[model samples]
Structures are given as structure tokens and as C-alpha cells.
Target chain A: MTAKAAMRKQFTLNPAALEQLFSVLESHDFQIVGPTIRNGTIQYDYIKGCKELPSGWTSEQERASCRLKRRKDDALFGYVPGADSLKRFLHPPELRLFRAERENGVFRILDNPAPAPKLAFVGVRSCELRALSILDRVLAEDRYPDAAYVAARRRIFIVAVNCTEPAPTCFCTSMGGGPEAGGGFDLLLTEIVSDNQHVFVAEAGTSEGSGVLAVLNPGEVTKEIMAALHEAMDRSKAAFKREVATEGLRELLYESFDHPQWDRVAAQCFLCANCTMVCPTCFCVTVEDSTDVPVRRAERWRKWDSCFTQNFSYIHGGSVRLSPKSRYRQWLTHKMAAWVDQFGTFGCVGCGRCITWCPAGIDVTEQIAALRGTAAPAASDGAG
Target chain B: MNSDTGMKPKIAIFKFASCDGCQLSLLELEDSLLDLVNAVEIAYFPEASRRMLKGPYDIGLVEGSITTHHDAERIQRVRRESKTLVTIGACATAGGIQALRNWKDVGEFVRFVYAKPDFISTLKMSTPVAEHVPVDFELRGCPINKLHLVELIGAMLAGRKPNIPTYSVCMECKRRGNVCLAVSASLPCLGPVTQAGCGAICPAYHRACYGCFGPMENPNPTALAGRFEAQGHADRDIMRAFRMFNAWSWQFRQVSEERERR
Candidate 1:
């Protein structure tokens, strides 16, 4: 499906307006984090201004591979999503839940009182926005809501960008997420960099976004600029090389629970939890309590965890998922099938971070396809 | 809570055939040393106080592997005396780098290196403390993390389990925001199979992990070795990786031996 241009809210802005947008977010006391080159890859980090963006840089990504290459034009959002996602800001890797101290034979429990940082996430893709909402369902909207996640999530201001150049690993088109910006962004942009023109076609999704746009007062969207935006969107839609056939995928995954394909995939899997770590929506966490001997102080910390870990399934007797095959099955089954039952949506957004970041180069799309073809014959049904 | 004697829990440090780097980690805890001393009596640590307090006491921190007949018998006696025995470092837990001799003939090495081959007496294989005696817990790493050493002692005193994670080193590397060298640069790394606790020191510096902390709780070294092979690494290179500090660790040993056979 082509990205429909929001005609009424669209405005054209020169390259300089992006720097002004940074200034606008900064004045409001938002810590701006966006894509920047660090340690030979584009990762989300604190940007001083638009200058910190990885301009004139594009990354080539495949299964278990990503390498940064110089683009012909100096496009800010030229590359696809990096290894990092918005999860790092909203749900931190490590968080102190509370601390208990003993003094004069009296024990006092103190909750963590650190304030959440107001964050303005720049260069957010549509799949990432979906990932944020998925996290919202898990952490904030669940029965026992995470106060920390809710607080941090409430203060975030999203600046979504439409993808013009899709990476080889990206399969967002098949999973109800595409290169176009969706409803969650405060301000959305489609970058158009050609020989004659280099500008951002902007649209405001929220009132605050329109306010920021009004301050910049960009020019009216012209016929030629809109044409270029359509071209970029069409190009991205056509470039998706990988896709998952999502039709009855939830049922297919359940039917293939005993499929031999699991063993084949498990043989290749490292069981390192890299896929879950890089995935934007994987939100499992584990808590640890530590004590300081001399001071008589105890603190509980929440750390990001994965289902792939043995301890993640540890019970009274032993680990439930003892084998690598069972652990891998739990992760994939939960993500594709059980997640729909729990959250009303598949856990994966098809951003392809898992594919590119995995050490074994395991492709989820290929695995799902394998399951669909040669799944163990149903006991009641006819032959495969 | 004190015992009937009204004294702190007695802690002893024992060494077998290690470099004593794990023992040095205790001294490296400069800021916490005084506090640790106050918490427990250093019953028998010849490395520090030269105090040779007898065992049959509390916790024993055993280091190194059983490389000789004398060391093997000593570990069994050490286990019999101590109320709780905890193995420290890769040497004590996974047999250390010296365990590479497990694949070779020690008698041949004695003849080559020593002037008097008859004088030297060593075990055929350098085996871990667990192979000789029952270990209550095992603290991994070539030279164990100073903070983890402190945590182990604190947990023992408090009658609780140590807050050590058994997950892969990749977890800590991702937490530190280090880009995957194996995925991005195609560098052969052992982080995927190695345990956490080193704070991913090697990967942060743009080098591959050498598996100093040993194989994690559930390591897939075979799959990781296959990945290394696919990356165009020679069988010798793959074999060298698994035959490091944790050479005799069954998970790593299986992969290294397979590579050697190939």
C-alpha cells in the first residue's frame, strides 16, 4: 500500500528548519536523542543538534550483517533503523526499584524518587512507533502498571520520519507497519533529497506539533514537492525484499508446535538472546536484590531480561525450558502466537533488528515460512 | 547474628595451581577491604596476613585447579573442613588455561622442559575443584570481578544467594551499548557463549571476548563455532577460542575437540 499524503496538514521546509526544530525541543527542556554514528555504526544517542545526525551516511543491512556506507547525498535519515530502539529510553536496561536501609536497629524502605527525563526522540520510524504502543500495552496498560514506564512514556515527544530507503532485512510491509509515519508522532516528515531540491515534507499529528511548525512557518507544500514525496514512498514500498505471510500465522505457529523445523532452527541458533535484546517490543525483565554488608543497606534492581535465558524459566525444581529447542520455541511461539492472545497484536513489528543483529544470521521470516510448508500433520486433519 | 562464640564468620582463602590473580582480587577491593575485615575474620589467607588459622570454620574461597596429586588430596581435605566451599575463578571452576594440557601428554612436556624428568610429578589432566570435591558455588572469570567477590562474601554472611547472573556476556554488552563486533564487523567473538560479570570489557574496546568468565548457564558453543566457521575462520582458530581459560569446561571442550578433529 502506498503512503497517503496528508494534504491538509502538509508543509515544505528547507534543510535548516530541522536545526530549528531541535532548538524548539531544547527550549522546552527535552533531551533530544537521535541516530548518530558511534563505534562504526548508526545508533541512537544524545545529539547536540542536527549536526550530530549521520548525514551522507547509509547503512547496508542483511541477515546478521550491517555496514555503514557513504551515500551520494547528505540525507539525515538516510539509513534504516539501527540496533537501538526507543525501549532504552522508556524502559531502561537497569533501574533501581527501591532501597532499604537499617539504622539504629530501625529499617526504612525508600522508593526510587528519581524523576523521569523528558525525551524528544528524533528519526523515529513507523515500526518503532508500533513497538512503543506494544510496550504501552505490556508495561503501562497491563494489570500491574509500571509507574516508571508510565511516567517516562508520558513525557516523550516523538518526531517520526518516513523511510525512503528500506534496508534489505526490513519486512515492515508484511506486518501491518510500513515506511510511512502512523498516528503516534507529534510531527512527521518525509525527506526528499534530489539534485534540484533538498527539503522535508512535514505534517503535524498533534497540536504541539502544529505549534512547532507554526513557529518555523515553512512554505506551502507545492505540487512538485508532493510528487517527489510520492516517488520516495513508492520506491520504499517496492524495495522490501523480505516478507512474512501473516495470514493465519498465529494458527500456523500453534499447529507447528511439534514441527521438526524447530530443531533445524535451534541447531543454528546461538540462544544468546541477541534477537530479543535488539527487538523493539521484547519487554521481559528480571529483578535482583543486593545488600551492602557493612552499611546494612539493601536495594532491589530491575534489569532487562530475555526468555532465552535459563533463569528466566527457573521454577522450584529446575529450568522449565532446559533445551535450546524449547527456549527458542518459547520465544518464537510467544512472539507470533501467544502475544496476539495476550495483547491483541503480534509482538514483532518486522523492523528486522533481530535479523541484522543476530550472530548466527537466523532469519525469522524464513523460519516462519519453513513452519508453514512442512508443519507436522495435525492429528485430526488430513495429510500435509 | 553471631555464633555461640560471639565472633564473625570465619573466611579462608585456599590456592591450588592458579596464578593467585583471583586472590589478588580480594586485595584490590581497597575501599571495601577494611569493611570486609570488620565483617569476617580472615581465618587463613597466607597471601595477605600470613595468618594460618585452621579450618573446620565457615566459608572457604578455593582457587586454581588440581594439577598435582598433592593439590588433589588437599582439595578433598579442604572441602571436608570448611562448612561451605565456594570455587573462585575459571581455574577452580572450569580448570583454567592450564587444562589445555588435558588434550596432550604431560609426561612429554616434563621431559622437554625439565632437566631431570624423574623429579617432576604432575597430574595428567588439570581438573577443576568440582571434579575433586563438591563445590557449594562457583565464581567464574579468569581473575574474578572484585565487586562479585565482595558480593559473594556478603551473600554468604547474610545467608542468601549471590546476585550473579548466568546469562551470556552479550546481555552486558548490549546493556553497555556496545555494537556487536561479531554481527557488524564479522569479528569472531565468544561473547555469545561466555557468561556475564566482566561488564563486557573486551567487546567495548572493539576486540572479541576471549571467554575469560567461561561458558554461560546455557551456552551453544557448537552453534557459535559453526558461525565462526561460516565467517571463514580456520578450525585451528575456532579451536583456540574454546581452548582458552575454560578449556576443560564440557561445553567449550566439546566444541574445541570437534574443531581439532576437523
Candidate 2:
């Protein structure tokens, strides 16, 4: 889809009037889940009014940087992503399948999938929107149809916001995913600051988006507004400080088994699994069951798993990947270059969550570059 | 013979040095778990069941490697107690990730990672159970392939040999019509040397095989490594690949050491 075709019937809302739009969105009977400063971080949650929004919020992230401070000026989407994207809400960490009930000599399992609420996720960044699309391919596709996720995803609305500022750890440009969302969202917003005006250029892609736009009674998208958005996206793209080349990356990465760089990184990796937890696309899971006090019945659940964990590779008599280096190799090689071969696309959204969230602060881009004779550059810190 | 006609085989799950991934694989079989439990007497699985029944177990599925001195002695007892002992993963068949210490001084590694080396008792190096006891069968994978695990258990139950591929991960990669990461992406893949069991999961997940399952029937480790170098990987990296999980296995050890020397 061309940028315009996916663009919603455009509308503009200045920063002063933005609160009215939030209230308008809240009043329209949709659950408004937007960004808020909770526990010293910008997290997505239900907001009752504009006061709940992180109005003057900004975040600082480095190789292992995480500090949130109020911005000197009001900028809604002026920060890097949190320890989360929208993955947790959409693809829950733990999913329970069905309940087993024994009746009349047969044990019947009832698959109790929750119906997704009419959720309006506000302030979603471009990469996050793309990450949702990857999740779309994994969960809602015709092949693996994750029934539980599909129900929640189908009737939802996405409010995508462009990134004017990029984190030092941010590298969405390399993976071809973000900074400016070209697709996946229902409505796209570009935060604009011109003199005294603080406005968001709004466009609707889906009909559900059209209905939401109509409620706000926002101005029609003008050619000037379109021009402004292009400028904004280009600025966002330029803001990217780190980039990974996805060019012949498949061959460049998948073919090289004897890369010296892996050991250097392996020496640093503790295999703590923080990277996978923060990653939006990783789907490794393990099942656990516990009886609810009454030992007669048991409830089983699937929990998030990371290949970095020692037990993840355990076979009957032993573990297959015996070393930290081996396990780390599997995870890195899979996410960056090999995911394309498996899923016909890159596994990473290039949000740099793995880098920033990693306690070790490993940069996948740096690791890949190292194999190609690129030395590890001096960084303020790293995320693993 | 008539009296034993209907008795189901008793199955016991065991663990070693590795993560609980192998046992978790069996547990992941949500729909089939109850049926599996119904078919076998789950005599013991310390990870799953607390009951430590004395075994002359019909089938013992051993999950890790002999990492500690106690584990070495324990495997001997298990060998005597079980009718069939199938080592589950890389750790059981070849000393696992912990085996990376096989190259370094054991005392140095022990003192480096642990707070007190004196309190810790370990073998000089990690080794697979097969080195200590006769193993009836061996299953390969980082985490044992749940599909293969189920089939193996079922085959034992029905008195037949389990159908497992003895070919390379390369074959499975081709069967799945996966774009050869090496041929297509020039990524450093270990498909040629790694065993076929993981079903090329890393490739399926958009990554190259890291040889989580060790050497296949006849792995051309040099050929794959040579291509990796051709694509710009250093000799240290090539050596590192073979020296990973299955470093002690003669097949992998020889190749990695040769590259290191060069």
C-alpha cells in the first residue's frame, strides 16, 4: 500500500487540543490504553483522562540505560519504548488453554479463549506497530492461527505515533521495520511542534479507524499536512544512530559457522534470558501445571521460555547446546539473519529492545558487524 | 507370556547437568500427556513427580550429562536399575555446554565461576553417560524433540524401534524446502555437522543451525567451516563452532583443535 492509501482520511490536532481528543476517545466507549509514567517508566495502560498521559515524559536509554525524566516541554511520543512494546497485552506471557471436567465417564476439555476487548492502544511507536504485524503473521495467520490472540487482535484499533527522537540503542533502520510506520496501524499520528503549536497529524487506514476519527471531528487531511508528515518521518529516520544492514545479511550471517566474534560476545553473555523477555518476537514457551489446593484437579499453563536457559536444550540424557557460547549462538543467529529463511522475513523488528534491555547490553548489530571485520565500537554501555 | 500380555511398560524420566528442557518437552504435550500417563506407569520423574520409587524400571529416559562425581556413580546405579536407558540430549550423549570447560583448566574454571572451589566436588571434566554405561538408545537435540520423544516412548511401548532420522540437519532443511542459509544468506550455519532432530528449528525460526544436536552420520565439518571462512569468518570462529557443546566428542574435537592450531 502506498503511504497515502494506508493513510487515514487525515486530520490535525494541536497539543493544546490533544487532551480534548483523549477525552473524546475515552468518552466514545472504547478502552483507551495509552502511555503513562508508572513505576518510573512509560508503560501502556488504561487512561481515564489526559492527566494520565505522560504529557511531559521523555526516556533515556543506552547500552544499558533506563531512566525516565519529565521533558522540559510537553511531547507525548517523545521517548524510546519501554521494557515492553505492545507484545504482552497482545500476546500474553502465560496462556491457559482449557479446563478439564469429568462428567459421565468421559473427561471433556473446554477451550476457554477470552474475547478481546475493543482496545484503542494510544501512542504506539512505528517499530511497535511493525512488531504487531510480525505478531500478526505469527498468531493470526491462516497457518498457525493462535485462536486466543486472534480474537483480541481482530476488533482492535492501533494508534501509531512517529519517533522524532531515537535511542542510542535504537536501530530500526537496519531491520527495515520502523521510525516511521508505513503500515499495520489503523490510525497514524505524527507529533508536530511548530512555534506555539503542538499538533498530531492523524490518518485512518481501516474503517474502525475512520469511525474513531469521525468522533474526534478533526480537520480533513490537507496536502500541507501530508508534506509535514513526510518531513517528520524523514527526520525520524535520520534520528536513528545505529543501523544493521539486512542486504545479503541472510548469506552473510547464516553461512558463517566459524565466526570468532561469537566467542567474544559469549564470554560476556551470562544467559540470564533478559533479552528474550524484552524481545517482541521471541515465542519459545514451556508448560507447567499445578493443582489448585484441591489435589484432585490440575490446571496447565504455557509460560515464556528462552533458548538461553540451560534447560531449554536439555535432551533425555543431556543438553544439546552444552556451552553458553552455543546457546547464545543459536539465539543471535536465529533472530537476525536466519528468521528470514524460516518465516520469510527478519525475526527482529529492530526496536533494539534486546540491546537496551540486556543487562550485558549486547548489540546484535555490533555482533554482526564484528564478523564482517567491524570492531566493537566504544558505547556508553550495552544491553543484553 | 500370557500373564504379562497386558502389562504396560513403566516409564521413568531422569535429569543430569542440563536444564529441564527435555522433561518440559514431555510436559508440553498437553493433549497427549494424559493419554501418555494412561499408557505407562510413570514410576519416577523427580522433576515431575516426587515419588522416588526403587526402580528396575522398564524404560529410563536420562536427560543430562555426568557433570559431578555423584552423577557418575548415580548413572551406574541407573544402568543397573533400568531395562533400557536412553540418553536424551547433547549433555547425555556428549558432555553439554558445561563441557566447554573441558579445554580450560578445571580448577581455574571451578574457582572462576563458583564462590568456593573447595566446597564443590566435580569430575575433572564433564562426560556423557554413554562413556560410563551401556545405553540402549540415544536421542539428540538441544532440548529433546518432543515429537521424537513421544514417538520413541510410543515405539518402546509397542515393541518396535523408534523412527529417528540419522541424517544431517541439512537433509531436514532441504526436506522443509528451507533456503540454505549458507547458499542463500551466506550465514555461518552448522547444518552439515549437526544431527537431524531439531527439524531445523533455528532455520524455521529464521536463524542458522548452531549444532545443538551434535555430529550427524557423516558430517563434513571442514567443508561447512571452509565455506564459513570463505564468507569472512576467522579461524578462531571456525574453531569456536566445533569447540562448542560437543567439544569432547572425537569427531568435533579433532576438527576444532586443528583449526585452533592453524
Candidate 3:
């Protein structure tokens, strides 16, 4: 089926019908992964059915805080992206490159086979989908693409959900990404909750999603369902507490390299590189070789590296960016500006992970506002 | 002598005033300990082996601090005998937690802790190894990371520089994909100023970093301290945060002192 025809077909699925969707994906040898409550935080983990989703739960996010609260209504996929992202699965923290062993005074290198698990990600948000697209461009679209990432990306499927109830830290609307699904999903779902009923309007983006929808045999879409979808989208768009003007932001950051805002932010910034690590689009890696005694056996491994490190820019003499001020400038500019120059797209997806996960409560949006000579609304009043 | 034999480099391990946790880290290299011994001659290590070879060693890994007059003199001699001297762990690099005496009167501390204060022989301050003798390198951590230890040894063997990172614990926490306790739970974390090591263990388990690895290279503790203040953290809380394992390090020392004055 063509993309246009698949998008034209819309259906409504009750809560029970959603369970059948899970069954269909599992039948296709896809390990279903979705958001679930773990250690008092909503984290994406492996789930068997819709029952494991964080139902009747929502989260409050601020500059330096996140808390899950019991909602009066049941809404799956209510919470936004947590610390884990698609980066965790595609670009793993550590991967073995190769192993070498000595045999008869000669060393032989052996390939470490990649583990490509067939995965179907359920409840992916719009900003996260954008992040996945950015990862595709960086890791898969390049000439010397990462073979492991390519192999993993090829076998996976995406089930995206339109975010109706966005967290306070959310600014996807400003980033031109979401609160509503635009594209890059196999299946898209929007939940409509009213006084006595809960229904999901589902749309397919590919043949695989259409096949899954056929098995469930959902009800025909009506004008009521479309109106509900519009309502939810509008409500979420208005709920955003933060706004970052991205138009010409790349140029503003590049021209304002000497702005004192960098030093001001760096003072409170830990240069911990947590922002890059949690950033779905930030991809940097370092390689190291470990060897056994007698130099008989050795293994090469690649682990996630961040630009916040003093050694990240290390050269023959010393690190180019030595101070926290310079390092923070490098990171912010690279994510917001240099990324556009290098990849023809912004590095950030506006998920606000960096704002919500910073131990020091540093907000990137506020810093950008400061760079623009305007004060960002205080985040100290707590979650709205 | 081993150099003439074309064998592994001779290595020595020494301890002064510490819990010996850093030396214990060497033993914790369960997977690579055997390989390490084969790669380098364990000429002198009282914690691991009974065999004690005299100095003039290729590399000497020193643990602990110079908290006594004898330690101050002995480190000088060790520096002369070893071709390369590396300090490992908090005590060797930043005087460890024992450096808390640097702020107080040692006479009172001895009298408070010991029944016979006159019998105790101690220096007024616990000083890092570099204070008494020049060090080739200093490994940062309360009990240094095993991966870094292995890498340093490998680098020494290859006559190259070790590639240990000098970033804060925030980097490690991000790499580990841990939710920030400071932001998520409003907990007072020292991760922003503390060096990355321990694989961000405390934060991974949902606790704040205790600055166990000391300050990162060119850490901006003033900014972190200001943020803590803005978050409504008490003055004592901010002061205590910087007065942890590596409190004697210049950056942490200055920050803690600044908080105390406030």
C-alpha cells in the first residue's frame, strides 16, 4: 500500500483492542518495549501487554525535579520521555569491537558478532521520533556508518503515540516536533478520554501497521474521533510552559560566541556531560583496548563518550577546551548550531531531558533566552 | 635488574596513612591480577605478597598520605629510588578524608580520640604525596577505579600516557543513563564538581555523589554551590558537600572555606 493510502485509513480501538495490537507485534517476533513504572520513575522497559503500561499515572517535570502522580483518569503513554531514549538501544553504552588471541606465536583477530534483537517500540513520543530520525542521519546515513547501529535499526519497528498531556519541561511545540505525530512511525495512536469512555484513534504509516490494524478489525473512524484528536492536540500545545524560538537560533548562538551568558551558565554548570548522554541525538564514542598478561589475548571496546570531558578535545599537547566555560560553549553551540552546519538539521529534539536531568537545575532554554537578552520565566516556582 | 634481563618492569606498592582501600583495588582486579603480575614484576607489595624486593624500581604505586614525620621523610627516599612514581586514590592524591584535620587543631583531635594523647605521634596536617615528593601522575578516587588502574599500568608498560578522563560525575551518570537525583529528587549532589569515576555508582543507585573522586579538572564549584543555594540548600549543607573525600584538594578546599565564611 502507498503511504498516502495507509494514512487515509483511520480506526478507533478500545483498550482491549490495543492488547491485540501488542499480540500482533509479538507474533511478528518483535520484543515489545514501552514505558513502565520502575524505581518510582517512568522508564522504558520490556512489556508483554498493555497492562504493564503506566496507566492512570502522569508525571510533573521542572528544571530540577520530576515526580509521578496518580491521575483521576486512565491514560497510557501520559508521561513524556524519561532518561532512557532510542539511543540506549541503537547506540549502546559499551560494545566490543574485536577480540584477539595468540596462537603459536601469532595473534589472530576475531569479529565480535552484533546482537540484533527484533524490537517494536511502543508508546514513542513525537520528539523521540525526531531524535530517532536524527540518529538515523548521524549513524546510518553517513558513508562510514556504524554497522552495529545499522543492523539494530533495520530490525526494529516504531509505535508512536501523540502526547496529549505533556510534562512541564516539554517544549516540543517550539522545537517543531510534537505533541502530535507528524511522521516517522509505523503506527500512531491518540487517546481520547471522556466522562464514561476511553477510545484511541489509530492511524498507520506503513504496510506493517496496516496489517496489524487489519487483525484487530477496529471500528470505522467517525467525525467524533477526528474532533477528539484535534482537541487533544490543541490542549497539549497550549499546556507547554516553556518556549524556545528556534528560528535563527543557530546563527544567534554562532555569532554570540563571546556572550557572557556562557560564563554565567558555566558557573552553575557541572560540565558533567549528562546533557549529552541523556540527549537522544548526541552521539560520541571513545575506544580502548584491554589485554591479558603475556600480551596473548586482547579485546577492543567502544564506550559512550561525552564532549563535556576535558580529555574530549585532547590533542598532542593538551585539551583544546580546558575551562568549563569553553567546554560548555562548545557543547551548547554544537548541539544548537554546529549540528545544523554539519548535518543540515538541529541536534536537539526539544525533549527537555537536559533541563529535567541536570543535577544543578541548569535549563538550556533559559540559557538561550539569556543569550537573546531576555530573562526566561523563573522555573523556581516549581511545576505548574 | 629486570630491564637487563629483558623482562617485565619492576613495580612497588606502598602505603602510609590510609585504610589501604586503594591497594585493595589492585587485588580486586580479579580478572586481570594474574595478567598484571605477569606483565610487571611485583617487586614490593606488602598488601598482596610477602616477597619484598629492594627499591630502585621501575614504577612505584603509592597509596595514602603523609600524616606523620616518618612518612614525610620516607616519600622523598622512595621518589629517588623509583624512576616513575604514581599516586593512587584520595589519600595519595588529595590527602583523603583524614585531611579534615587540616582545618582543626591536631592537638585537640588527638586528645578527643585517644586516651593518651601524649603517646600519639602525628603531623598537624595530612598531606598528599605530591606535597613531599614529585609524582609522575595522580589517580583520582577514594578507591581508584580498576579500569583506570589497568590502563595506567598498561600505559606505563608501553611508555605512553594514560587516557583517564578528567570530566565530572555528570558525564558518567549520563553515559550510564541514570536519572539525576539532584534534579529528579531535589537531592544535594556533588556530581557537577566531583570527577568522574566509580561509574557514577551513587547516582546509579538513586543517591547524590559524595565527591569521592575529587574535583574535576578546572571545576567551577562556586557555580554549583550557588545553584545549591538557589535550590534553598542550607549553608552547612553546601559546606559539607565540598568537605568530603578530596576536601584537601585546592578547589574543594577553597569552595568549602568560602561557604564557611558565608
Candidate 4:
């Protein structure tokens, strides 16, 4: 049970005049945050109005490639999420914890206060919604809570849009998460059969969601319209081109820790640390202290870190996992097998961002399959 | 390494066998360095300070590989004194770019990288820290991330598990929105096999990775090489690609060996 509970409601939206939808949101005293083109990616940001959104934009993504193209029709929420999830907003890359200043003969620590505001996050995708929940588990943990994260998460609204199209790197289905926002959203919008009438079957999941709906003054939605929306969702789920296998992953990885394959993989691994930076779940970090010159004030801060770095495990007079092979094996085992022992869930979300964006184009799904006992000889096993 | 009676974790950073890029990153911590100094007592780091302290330290960071009898002996001694031993850098991990010599006669490499083998003390192959002792954890990357480095220390200090990824580099590139160099430009990339740590730097730099970080969990290098081949990379080029910084990694080794056979 959480501190707050969800409420439910449903309605239909006019897709052709979606700008009116944005205006309606504005009229309700909600600040709109939605997707817009930025630095060659469809990123979410605070928009001045509907014109700031990528109204006529579409993106092309594959296993190691992505590009944006202009669309023929002016549809506001037509594109899939770019590389970032809502985690970027909730848990920022850089955050200030506290400041230490010397006043009189003593050192004083002042916590950085956060400004909480009511926001309406539009175009929320299913995978991103799941990612947000994953973050919720991490930041909102029992023992040690991330105060900064807690501050950013209060009194927010989520507007989840069903995926009408799937990107090549998407594999949320394998993660048992989605192309759909089942429980983590305030409003779920399914765009179904739009030509003369651009319609979205909207459903509310919280009291706050109901409050937002009451402001929209939207027309009634019948059972037939809801059935059509369900059909649209089914079709979108079938459109995913990529998938990840989560069956028996923990048992297989735990049992195969000493399998010779780790050494084989280590042979070609660069140990670059790219996957950690983009992973939605990796939360390792280190603390540092900054000192104010001419004074005795020092403030400690935490920053993100990875296990792939050479100095990550240095202990005593030496390191235990010295080789890339062993280090890599340790990380792999922990993420898939041991993480379940610790977190009671597999760490992977099957987003496939690690595959499509790697400079080397590493495929995690294929590697897991190999570890699960499908490792054949190298396809180019004898070219030297 | 010096513990200084009962103080913070006595940290020691050591290096051997390869270029000092990873060690340099420690010094590169810049503003974070002072805070790090307060977090742990850096008992022995020739690169950071001149004060040498003797060991039986708490945490020891060993970089580079065991390429000689002396190095192997030194690693054993390092393992003996430390409470926890962590390996830093590629040479100490996948044997660095130098492990490529493990595939060939060391004499050939000696003739290539050095002018005088007569004065050099050498071993048949370069190896990572794990080959020597029991390690508590391992940080990947040619030059490990400063942030990840800090996180690992914090985890150890707190006696908590560190959260590092075991996935591939492709995830990072996508996060940064870098166009896929391999698929879009037909560049040979090892993102499929390499561990995730480097922040997708190479792809951001418009160059494919050379796998300096070593292999991630369950890397499928061969399937990826085939993809490269389909993009018009020749068998020779693919082998060359696999033979870079992490070339000696077995997954890559087998892939290139397959290409070498064809």
C-alpha cells in the first residue's frame, strides 16, 4: 500500500483538434510538459503551447540507428519516445544535495530545498511509465530514501498515450512491462480509428486524474468506443519488432557463473561502460567532498558510478576480480541472477537501448540466449 | 598501503604492464579528488602524492596486467595484505590492448613495440588482476568513469552492493541519441559484446568502439560480426576490428579466429 491511492474515470478526445486539448489542459491551471524535437531526438520538455510540440514529426530507429523525419499529417502525439524516459525528469543526472558553509566557529550544513510544482506530463509511453515505476522502487525505498527524488515526485500528473507504432529497439513486452500503461498512469489515452473524427478513449486512474477530467468538459464515451480502443491497443501490442526472453533467467545465470563463456566474452569486451550510463535501473554511485577555500567547510556529494571501471573493486593491497572476464562475469551474474536475490526482481527491463545505441552494437538478448545454452561457434569462427 | 592505526579505508592504487590511462583518470577526478581524499586515506598512489606508505591496507586498487614473473609475484604479495582487492584498468582486466600478443609470439610484439628486447623483462601474456587473487569487485573501462569509481567506493564503505550494468554499449548510444554508427554508417562496432561503462563516448565521437572495456555478460560477438559483414566489412577488416584494445577476449578471439579460418 502507498501513501496515495488511484481513482478511475473515462472519456473520448477529439484528435483533429488536439491543440484544443492542450488549451483545455492549460485552462485547468496545469503546466504542460510534452515531447518536442531537441538535439536530433524527440525529448520531453516544458512547452509554451501546442505549437512547441512536434506536431508533424516522426522518428526512425533500428538496431544501431535513429533519425527524425517530418510527417505529412499534423498529429501531436504520433511519435514514440526518443532515447530518454521520464526518469530524466524525476531523477536528474546532476542534483545538489546540501551546502556546507562556515559561520562563526562552527560548520553548518544547509539542505538544498526543492520547488514542487503541479505538472501535466503528456505523451507518456508504456515502457517509460514502467521505467518510472522502476525508479520509484529505487528512490522511494524504505531504508534510505532519496530526498531529492521524493521532492520532484510530489503532486504530478501522468497522461499515458498508447503506442500506435513500435520502434525497432523496443522490447518492453519481454520485460512484462509494455506498450501499455496498465497501473502507473493518471490517464490512459488510446487513439482509435481517426479520419473525420480524431478520437482518443481516455480513462482516469486516480482522484487527481478525475479532477483533471472534470475540467476538460469532454463528451460521453459509449461501450462501443471503449471496445474499439481495446482493439487498437491489441494491434499496437502486436507491432513490436523486438523481444527479450525472461524465462528461467535467474536459475540459468546463477548456475552458469563459472561457465567458460564469460572468459570467451571477455576476450572481445572493451569494458567501455556505455551500457551503465543509459540503463534505467543501474544505481551505483560514489560520494565526493568539495571544500571552500580559506575556510574549513566541506560538502559531500554522490555521483553515478559503474562496475566496469578498473578501480571499481580495488580492496586490500589488490583486487579480487582482476580480469575483464571475471569482472564482466560478476556484473552479468549480479544483474540477472543475484539482483533477484537482492531486489526480488530481475534488473533488466528489456528496453533494448543497450543494443541499438552501442557503438559496437552489442546484443544483450543474444548474449543471454547464449548463456541460457545456445552458444554456437562464432559465425566467423575461422577467418584468420 | 597505510591504514594509520584505525582510520578510513586505506586505499592504494597500483599499475603495471600497460599505458597509464586508467591511473590518470584517478588524478583526473579534479574537483572530486579532495572529497575522495577525505572519503578514503590514499596510502599509496605514486601518481597522486609522493608520500609512500607501507601496507596491509584496507582497499587496494591494482591496474595493469601480469606480464612477467615479477608482476605475478607482486600481485600475490598485494593479495596477501589487503582486506579487499579491486582491479582497475583494461590491462588488469582483459589484459589491455597488450593481450593481443597472447594470440601470437611475444617475440614478434617485442620486435614491434620496443627497439631492444635484450633489456626488457617480459612474460608470454598480459593478464588481469583476477588471475592473481580473490577480488571483492571489478570496475570496467579503459579509463573507468569517475562517477562509477566514486560509487564503488561508497558501496564498499557502506558494505552495500554496487549497482553496475552488465549489458552492452548500444543502450548508452541510444540514450544520447547518437545515430547508430554500425547500422547507419557500416562501421564495425563491438557494442554487442563490450561491457557498458564508457558513456557511449566512442559513438559520440563518431567512431566505433574498439572494446577497451572487455566483454559484458553473454556477449554474442560472432552474430554481430556477421552483421558487420553484411554491411560490407571484409573478413580481414572484421578480424582487424576484433584485434584492437580488447582483441584477446575469447568471444572476440573466436569470432576473429573464425574469420581468420575463412
What are the TM-scores, per candidate, against the unseen true structure?
0.96, 0.59, 0.94, 0.61
Q: Evaluate all candidate structures by whole-model CA lDDT and list the values in order.
A: 0.89, 0.72, 0.84, 0.70
Docking class of 2: incorrect
Please provide, for model 4 over B201-224, each residue's C-alpha lDDT reduced to its tens digit, 9 standing for 90 to 100. 998988887786778766767767
Error of 1 at B88 (Å): 0.6
lDDT of 1 by residue, B123-241 (tens): 99999999888899989998899899889787766767789988899999998889999988999999999999999999999999999999998788998998888888999999998
Q: Which stretches of candidate 2 lie over 4 Å from their true place?
A: A1-9, A20-29, A102-106, A220-232, A292-295, A377-384, B1-262
DockQ, model 1, C-alpha based: 0.57
- Candidate ordering by DockQ (highest first): 1, 3, 4, 2
Tens digit per residue, CA lDDT, model 4, A1-384: 122322345677665345666776777677788898875667678886668878778776665555677876666677777655666566655455667876665778876565755677888887777766767777777478777677777656788887876676677788777666776888777766555445777777777666666666666888778677667767777777665567888888878868877876676554655566566677666555554322345466565556765556768886576677777777777778887787677677767666554444456666676787775322212211
Colliding pairs, model 1: none
Which runs in model 4 stand beyond 4 Å of their true positions? A1-9, A16-31, A69-75, A102-105, A116-119, A193-196, A222-224, A292-299, A318-320, A374-384, B1-262
Native contacts retained, all candidates in order: 0.63, 0.00, 0.63, 0.10
Which candidate order results from sorting by lDDT in descending order? Answer: 1, 3, 2, 4
Q: How much DockQ does model 3 earn?
A: 0.55
TM-score of chain B of each: 0.97, 0.94, 0.95, 0.91
Q: What RMSD value applies to candidate 3? A: 2.6
**Model 3 chain A poorest 10 in a row by lDDT:** A1-10
Question: Candidate 1: deviation at residue A96, Å?
Answer: 0.8
- DockQ (C-alpha) of model 4? 0.09
